[model samples]
Target: MTQRVPHVLVVGGGYVGLYTAYGLRRAARKGRVRVTVVDPRSAMTYQPFLSEAAAGSIEPRHVVVPLRTVLSGCDVITGRVTGLDHGRRTATITPTEGAAYDVGYDHVVLALGSVSRTLPIPGLAENAIGFHQVEEAIALGNQVIDRLDVAASQRDSTLRTAALTFVVVGAGYAGVEAFAELEDMARDATRHYPTIEPSDLRWVLVEASDRILPEVSDSLGRYALAQLERRALEVRLDTRLVSCVDGHVVLTDGTELDADTIVWTAGVRAHPDLVGTGLQLDTLGRVVCEPTLAVAGCRHAWAAGDNAAVPDLTGEDGALCSPSAQHAVRQAKVLARNILRAIDAEPLQSYRHRHVGSVASLGLHRGVAELYGVRVKGWPAWLLHRSYHMSRIPTFNRKLRVVLDWTMAMFFRREVSSLGSLQRPAEEFRRAASSTAPRAS
Candidate 1:
């Protein structure tokens, strides 16, 4: 009788999906198990570097790892997992350009990850853009430069002021870094526009909370606030965006401003698709998982990362792991090993690790970091932030490329050109075709 090899279906190609499958490569090569990864995009984005990518400190392409290239040992499906029937060990996958199909699996890894968590502020849906993906980062960079160009050409002072103003909601890592870095980029870009001065630009960061960089120490947050204020950037705390209708921003504190760009990076919720998986989920809609990273009450099912509520053994009682890359990457390794152990009917180890600390870049040569209760700031923190992420971004190829980007950036001025037309590459062709079309008789 031939033995049946277990099929592991990993949903979502983010940190957990990529790392878990990469961890199982040895077993996969030996034919001990078969692995398949599914995601909307074929590449896994290193999100921590997105701010730099947006600021042109690193090339946008360098921040994402091509899933097919990295996961050559596994099957890569360019699609979305619409639903899951874990009882039958099957998942329904909807491809980018075809009918939905069912994929049978012996085990499943729910790494669906999270999406931008937005509020129902008036006109927000129409005017705001999220900063969670590389595409958004690219669009934002282009938009900033394009706005600068518009401001420089406009004769009306009010219109130019509106074009020069940029607003970023939420002061978390994503928002603060994006706010700082893009401001730096635009400030440096003013040199190219002889008509524009750095003083003409207005960068505003609004956070409902009382402080920014909540992930770091309060002292560090204060320092970041001081640094940003010193740069003449507006940091509004304990303030909410009441409305942003047609580039007109109204705040809860009765502040009104005209801003052409409004960035949303408040927070993220677990993948909404989990509701259809029929798995046990917490009130927050995250899959409930044991410390071993196995889905609770579900056989042959596993989960980790932002999608799963895994217990934090190192924290106080009833504390769940935080949905950060630090936890997600570590959880992936433990999840993979536990899956293999389950296949072998061996003891499973629990996922437990005290978080080392946090690090965030304010902009070039400015940052804040806390490691093992030791706080660091300024240039040393900036270097630490770079070195740490450089070590974490997967693959030596990507690492080398990123290093080279930084090395070159040290000697050359950052590119400030806008390629907004890339967003509508077919517009020109369509216009030309319409112009040459035969007139109706």
Candidate 2:
């Protein structure tokens, strides 16, 4: 008699999906279960290191883990999970450059991550960029450097000032770190341009809330605000961006400016696929899951990471776990273990881990951290930030590469060249071909 191997379909190859699939690969090899990981992206991005990559502290390639390289024993599908029917135990998959199809599974893990939440502010969607993915980080670096090029070459003061001005919205870890890192890079690069002065570049951070870095204590947040202000950055609190029409910014506080660069990092909501999954969700549209990380009203279905609202046992109140990389990574471990137990008909354990403190890097040799009730600021915090994230960056290959990048950076100046043209490689060729073509008779 032949044994039947269970099929588990894991959605979204981000943190949770990658880790879960990686963990189950051994079991999959032994024929206990067959695992398939589905995502639109072929690689899992380590988002914590995105800001550093943008700042040239670490190479972008080192921050993302290729799914096929890491998950050796599992099937890695480069496709999007468009719809889920838990009752029917099937998922609708739409592959890039292929026909849509359904995949059957005995168990399903919905690790679909979140997307940026944007408001209806005028001209936002058309004008601003996001800071979530590797491509965006790369584009941001190119954009900043290209802006500097424009500032250096343009004799028009209005256009030059607009080119030099950079605006970053939201002051969370992503917002603050991105703003600081890019500004630091731009400031450093100014030495090479005789026409561009360091003081000529204007970096502004705007947050609608009264405070920044709300994950940290109020005092620490105040300290970060002061540090940024010391660098001559304009920190706008209690203000809203009313419009950004044609790069002309109008704030609620009657402030107006023209900036060629605008970055949005306000917040994120769960992937909209949750609504179509027909799963129970909280008010915020995150899947409601039990402590064991199982979907609230379904068997053979589980969820974790940013998409699931798991109860925070550490909070001691009715609070749910905060959507963060810390919780997502930890929950993936627990989620993998429980799935194995379920296959073996063993008892499952609950996911309960206290929230650790937060850390943020403000450019090279500067950071702020609150860890285990101990607050550290300045250079020490920056070192700790790098060390902690380096330790958490996934594979040994990537870890070694990141260390090599840091070690090499110590001996050489950071690369600040603008490769923005890579975003549109065919433009030059198209222009040349058009110019050489014969006119219509």
Candidate 3:
């Protein structure tokens, strides 16, 4: 008689899902276990390099790893897991088109990552864009360049000032890097426009907290503040974006400015889809997990990354692991191994790792890093930032491409041209079709 093979369904294709499947690739290739990954996006983005990609320091394609290419041994489904019934070991998938369907699995990994945490600030949803995905980053880059074009050609001083101003809300890693990198890119871009100067551009970084880069040390944060101010960029700490209606920005500090670009990088919340899973979630809506990275009290269910509240064995009691790539990547290895061990009837090992320090880039040739109790800043930190992320981003193919991009960038200038037509690809066709339409007499 033939034995039935266990099917492992991995939800979400971010760091956790990708690395977990990659870790289990050998077992999958040997027919020991069947693995399937499902997500809305077919590619997994290396978020740390997004700022560089937006700033044209790296090609956008190089920052994203196509799941089918990396997880060749696993089934890749481009859809969302709309519902989960662990009691029946089934998940409902809703594809981009067609009807929804259910798939049965012996084991499931809930790796649903986080989404941008937004507030109810008036006109925010309509006016600002989030900096959490590859598409958003690319659009933002194009928007900045397009604004430069608008600023250079506008006749009215108020309209020109509005077009030249850029605002970023939230000063976390995403916001700070985006703020600095985009500013640097725009400053360099002014050289191409004879009508625009570096001084003509206005960059603003708004944070509700009292300091920027809260992930790093206070000293490093202060240094980052100094660096940004030196570049003539505005840093507003302990301030909130009160409103941004029609490109008119009103801040909590009573300062108002006209800005055509507004970026929201506040923070992230656990994926909202967890409610449909019927799994136990914490107060913050994250799935509750045991030390072994298994869903608490559930059979053959596991979770990690931003959506799982896994106890941090290395931290003080009652503390859960933070949602960061460093922890997510490390947690995935353990999660994969434990799943294989469960199939073999072996004891599962607990997940535990001490928190390492943080690193962040402040545009080209400048950064801040704290590694193993050693603090570094400036060019050394920048190099460390690039080197660390380079070693961490998945796949030799992507790594090689990224290296080539940097190699080419060393001898050539970054591309500043904006392809704004990408935002409206059918506009030209629609216009041409309308022009040639037969007149009704």
Stretches of model 1 off by over 4 angstroms after superposition? none
Return the number of clashes found in candidate 2.
Answer: 0
Candidate 2 residues 290-321, lDDT tens each? 99999998999999999999999988778799
Q: Which parts of model 3 have CA positions greater than 4 angstroms off?
A: none
Per-residue lDDT, model 3, residue 195, is: 95
For 1-441, candidate 3 gives per-residue lDDT tens digits of 989889999999999999999999899999999999999999999999999999999999999999999998899999999989999999999997889999999999999899999999888999999999999999999999999999889999999999999999999999999999999999999999999999999999999999999999999999999999999999999999999988799999999999999999999999999988999999999999999999999989999999999999989989999899999999999999999999999999999998888999999999999998899999999999999999999999998999999999999999999988988999999999999999999
Q: Where does candidate 2 clash, by residue pair?
A: none
TM-score of candidate 3 relative to the true fold: 0.99
Give each model's whole-structure lDDT. 0.96, 0.93, 0.95
Name the regions of candidate 2 deviating beyond 4 angstroms: none
Residue 68 error, candidate 2, Å:
0.6
The local distance difference test score of model 2 is: 0.93
Between which residue pairs do clashes occur in model 1?
none
